[model samples]
Target: MKTAYVKVPFQFKFEDVPVPKCGSNEALIKVMACGVCGSDMNAARVEAQDWQSFGHEITGVVMETGENVSNVKVGDSVLVESGSYCGTCAQCRNGRPDLCASGTGLFQWKICGFSEYMTLDKQCLIPFDPEKIGYAQGTVIEPMGVALDLFYTTDIKFQDDVAVVGLGPIGLMALRLAKAAGARNVYGVVRNRKNTARIKLAKEFGATDIIYTDETPLEAYPFPAGGVDKIMVTAPPSVIASTFRAANLGAVIAYIGIDYGDRGTISFDANYFHYKKLQLRASYAVPALYFPRCMELIADGVIDVDKLVTSTFPLEDLEKAMCTLRDDKEKEIKMVMVRPELL
Candidate 1:
């Protein structure tokens, strides 16, 4: 089997590797498409040591199932949740599987994805209709699930004004979800480079206004103080305080940025937060708990998955794809790589 590895920082190489085997209770999944996650770019730029195994946003077909597997079968078009939850955990017992411990996997053992083929427990497999979303687009459910989790972290009441700082895929999807959930006015914030162009698409998704933080000062965001009812900071830690600066009186701010390196902190006006009754919360990937609704949004045509994708490459272009994502911030937003044999 041919597999891709990060030869070093800023590089990826494909080489022949043995195919992974399945356990008695697991199933083998042939990769169809694996979307390049934003975190991949993080590991690429920061030189994270354990980034060789990429592709958490994966969608594949079941090639074989173990004797004990009953929920999934061969020929099923599926996505793996990767055993994100431990049912015994306090969060899990309270029905918050997304907050599950990281040690457990789908089959109650360790699971490693992002190869030509891999094994997972049937419990981790989620079957989806290819006709509705197709193989490549279905891979988006992984990031979408995380975006959905952010929604759960905050109360985005129907018709409330909302803002999403950093108009990346997650922010873009959150914009769309806010609209679908009936946000009266959706605001998008982005840097003033070529990234500001993303605001045009954000408007298409649901944003009513675009705050060019690069051109406009953060303290001057939304103008005259009292701004959006709710804000989600999808960018970095530095953007957290900016959200508060642009926040309205009694607003809720949800953030989801993990700075693996560097100081991930920012300074903001404490008086503003106190006087405005501002709220803040940090959000992270929650064990793929929202896969079903994520798929349903794509399948039901509620989410524009096609528009979200910027590029698609074959296995041979793995290096180019990673480099493009790392360097090409202006044009590329989301990309997926399809390994034909893995399908």
Candidate 2:
């Protein structure tokens, strides 16, 4: 089996290794497709480390299951959860599995999904009806779960005016979900750029307005009822403060992002927040909830995964795919690489 790895400032390569073995409680998955995430590009640029495996957004087939595995069987098509909750955890017992403290996997397997075959704990596999979804669409379930988490976290109300700062795939999904949930005005915020691809899709997916930060600051955007009732930020931590300025009185702000060093810290107006009775919530889609719901949304024609998945590459084209995603963000929304033979 061949697996992808990256190290140093920007080095990436593939190495042949023995196919991973399924543990007593694990399942061996024949990876069919994996989506390249923005964080993967960021890791290649900023992280310095020894050669390590990366890609996580995954959809695969169950080739084998350990003796203890029963949730799924061989030949079952599945989407791997990047995270899973321990059923024994206190939070799970309290019916709040999303907050499970002992939940495992920021990414399920040590070997990663960027390989021909990998083994993971059976708990991370969510079996889906392959007849209803294709491999490429399956690759998006994880990210859709993320968007759903942000939607629920913000508690967006019907007829509420909303602004989604950062028009990445996740941001686009967020805005679309907000619109489907009945938000009156869906705003997709982006930095000034000429690539109208994202801006145009935002409208197609239900964004009522596109706010280019350089042209008109989010704080100055004219939304109904004084300002947007809800704000969802999927950008870096730095954008949180200015994005919050667009929120209406008593509005809720939900954000999911990560940054290292000084860039991780953000400063916003505490007095203004207090006076406005604003609620700020952090959304981390751990335990990777809502896969089934996301799949339903995709299958029922609500999400239109084909529109968001702008490009596909075979596994052999990993380098080209990564470069396209890193250097040409304007064109590609979500890139998925597949093993055609495996598929």
Candidate 3:
């Protein structure tokens, strides 16, 4: 079997290794298609002495399953969870599996989706009908689950004004979901006009307005009703304070992002937040709920996976794909790596 790994300064390498053995409660999945994430890009840039395994948004077919595994079987098409909760944990027993602390590591697999074959606990597999969804479309479910989590954190009402900071895949999807949820004016905020493709897609995906921070800061956007009813930030933490400036009074702001060092620390007006009665919420989708509903949304054409997945490459071409995604921000959206034969 062959798997992909990355090193600091954005380098990629491949190695051939023995196929992993499936445990009694595990299933072996033949890789089909895997979505490259912003986090994966972050991982590639992190300082590390050895190559680090990456790629989690995956969709594949079950080639083998252990005798004890009943949740999935051979020939089942599924979306693999990047991590899962321990069923016996207190939180899991109480029905809040997302809060379980003991199962935070990547399940039994050594390397994830960027491979020829991978095996994982049966509990992490969510079967989908292959006839209805293509391998590439199947990979979008996990990220949509992520976007859905951010949406759930906000109280967006019909005709409400909503703004999403950062136009990454998750951010773009969040804005689209806002439009489908009935937000009268959906705002897509970007740092500059260099992201022409994404800005155009934002409007196509139902953004009623676009805010470029380079020209006009978010806090001074002249939004109707003084500002938007709800705001979702998918950018780094550094941008959260500015995003808060664009929120309407009594509005709720939900965000999901990560940063290290100075960029992670954020500062905002305490008096402003208090006087405005605004709420700030953090959305971290783990044990990753909402796959079924999100899949339905994609299947029903409410969220078009095809439009978001702008490019696909063979696993061998991952370096080329990553370079395009990083340097060619204007033309790239979501990039996927696939095993042609499996697909």
Candidate 4:
């Protein structure tokens, strides 16, 4: 088996290693397609101290099932939920498995989707129809699930005005899901002209308006004085401050972006939130329970996952793909690694 490891900053070395043997409750999945996530970029940039394995948004076929893994059989197509949670944790007891504190190190040490094969517990697998959704489309379920979590936590209703900050994959997915969920007007805030093409596609997906921060101030948008009813921040910490500024007094602010900094701060009028009763919420990856619903949505053709994918590369070109995603931001959206032979 061949695996790509981020041994150090900006360096990826491919090594041939023994294939992992599945445990009694785990299944061995042959990687079909894996999406390079923004978090993977953060990992490659040495954001975390551990030697993190790349690729989490993934779709694969079950090659071998363990003795007790009856839910998934050999040849079943499925999407792997990268985040793990202990079913008995306090957060898990409250039905928020994504925040399970005891399962904090699942992505840090265990195998990731970057390899030719991934060993996942039965709880992390969601069966999907490969005929209805391609491998590229299947790989987006994780990010889409994250977007779904944002909407699930808020009190958004039909025709509500929503603004999504940042045009990353998750942000774009939020734009699409918000509109699908019945938002009247959807706005996308982006910093670079690199996302112009994606912004245009966002319109097709659901965005009614697009705001490029490089060209216009957040306050100058056409929204009312209080601004949008809800704002989802998918950009870095710097942009999140602006997202807070543009949000309506009583609006919901969902922070879905991953920030590594601790120095940035937002200065907002406390009375605004107190008088209007604003809701500030932080959302991470989707809960495991939502995976089934997300998979059904994808299988039903309600959300077009294929359009979110901008490019696909062979597994051998992992480094080149990373560079293209890092340097050529304008030319790519979501990049997937496909194993042609395995398919």
Candidate 5:
């Protein structure tokens, strides 16, 4: 078997490794496809974390399972949960498994998705009908769940003018979900003009407008009265105040972007922040509570996974794919890395 690790300074390396043994309650999975997330990009830059063998959004087939594993059988098609949590914890008991402290080292030692062969507990694998949704679409369930979590946490309604600030993969998925949830005018905001690839798809995903903030000023946002009803910020924290800048009266801003930096401070006028009655909320979704619903949506054709993914890479080309993301982020949207033998 071969395992991959994303080293610092944005590099990818692979080495020969033994296939992990399946435990009594675990499943041995054959890698199918793994979605390259924005978080993966963020993880590639840090010095403190291990980028080697760190991918969570994965879909694969169960090659074998331990004798006692009954949740999934051999040949089951499934999407994997990234973290292991103590089910008895207070957060777990309260249905907030994302907050579980037990799984604090998510990307450190977990080698499942980025490797050619992987192992995970049976409970971490969610089975779906592969005939209905293929492996590529299957990989999206996890990330889509993150977007769905943000949508579920907030209050959105029909005809609400929604603005999504940041056109990354999750932001694009948010655009699709906002449209599906009945937002009348969906706006996609980007910081670069070279992000034209994502902007075009944002329109297809039901973005009524695409705001390239670099070319167009924030003051020129085309909302009738003021700004948008709800703003979903998926970019850096520095841009949060700008979302407030283009916000409507009593708008809710759900922020989910993460950046490593001394660049966290955001400035906005105190009077406008008060007069408009703006609400800013952090949208951190995990433990994949909405995984099933998201999978069903993709399976039933409600959400088109076909449009969201712009490229696919063989596992051998993992470095090239990650570099494409690092060097050409503006032109790229979503990607799937696959092990050819699995399919």
Candidate 6:
């Protein structure tokens, strides 16, 4: 099988590697589609040390199952949870596997979903209905789960006002989820003209207002000071400081952006937070328990994952896809690589 891997910073190569054999408790998944994530760009920019592979958001078909893998069988369509956790870990026992104390987490290394075939532990697979959803939609389940985690961290009421300080794919997902959760007014902030199109889509999905940062200053927005109940920051670290400055006091600020190196810092008014009792929280990947609910939400039509997809590429074009994402942020939202031969 030819596995696509990041050989060095901004360099990708297709290496002919031996197919992985399923372990007793693992399953062999034939890659269907794997979404190229923003974090993957960060990984590609950093020099590759080991023969590491770089994708986590994946959806595929079960080609072979290990002897002990009964949760899913051959021909089952599924989304990979990507984040591995030790069942006995403190966080896992507390039903918050996103904070798994185990060393098997995705943050430690790569999962290599951008390949012809990938093997996963049985516990990391979430079976879904493929007839209703395509591989592109399934591939985004992981990121959507991350968006759901932001809501889980904050108190989101149906009538509350919410704002998202970025219009990336994840930020767009947060916009959609907020509306689905019955938020009265949802706002999306973007700077680029292309991103403005995405923000408009947010309005179609559920946002009541799309704030183009380039057109209007954050302070000039109609939302009053401390008017927003919750805010999600999805912009890169370079823009986060200003985004944080605009956040309403007493609002729940959910930081979802992954800082790329030391781009910049976020400055907050300590006095404002102290007097207004603001809650600042950071949300990473979603917990395993949330996968089932996220899948259910997709199944029930609460989230249209397909609409968020902007482009697709073949696995062999991994480098091109990554370059497009890194260099042309304004043009692309989410890009997914598909391995049709493997499927």
lDDT, candidate 5, residue 15?
A: 86
Q: List the residue pairs that clash in candidate 4.
A: none
TM-scores for all predictions: 0.91, 0.96, 0.96, 0.91, 0.92, 0.90
User: Which residue segments of model 5 deviate by more than 4 Å?
Assistant: 47-51, 84-86, 95-98, 103-109, 267-271, 329-331, 341-343
Regions more than 4 Å wrong, model 6: 47-51, 103-111, 224-226, 286-289, 329-331, 341-343
For model 3, residues 267-337, the per-residue Cα lDDT tens digits are 88899999999999999987777877988898788888888887888999998888888888688788888
- Candidate lDDT scores, in order, read 0.75, 0.86, 0.86, 0.78, 0.79, 0.76
Worst ten-residue run, lDDT, model 5?
Answer: 103-112
Model 2 per-residue lDDT tens digits across residues 1-343: 9998877677888999998889889999999999998778777877637777888899999999999999999999999899889999788999999998686675445798778898988888999876677788788889999999999999998899999988888999999999999999889888887656788889899888788889988888777677889999999989988876787889898999888889999988799989989998999998789987998888778898888888888877888888876677787788898877634
The digit string of per-residue lDDT tens for model 1 on 16-59 reads 77776888877888888888877777767665465365556777
Measured by TM-score, how close is model 1 to the native structure? 0.91
State how far residue 305 of model 3 sits from its true place (Å). 0.5
What lDDT score goes with residue 316 in model 2? Answer: 76
Clashes of each: 4, 0, 0, 0, 1, 0
Selected candidate, larger lDDT, 3 vs 6: 3
Q: Name the lDDT value of residue 25 in candidate 4.
A: 87
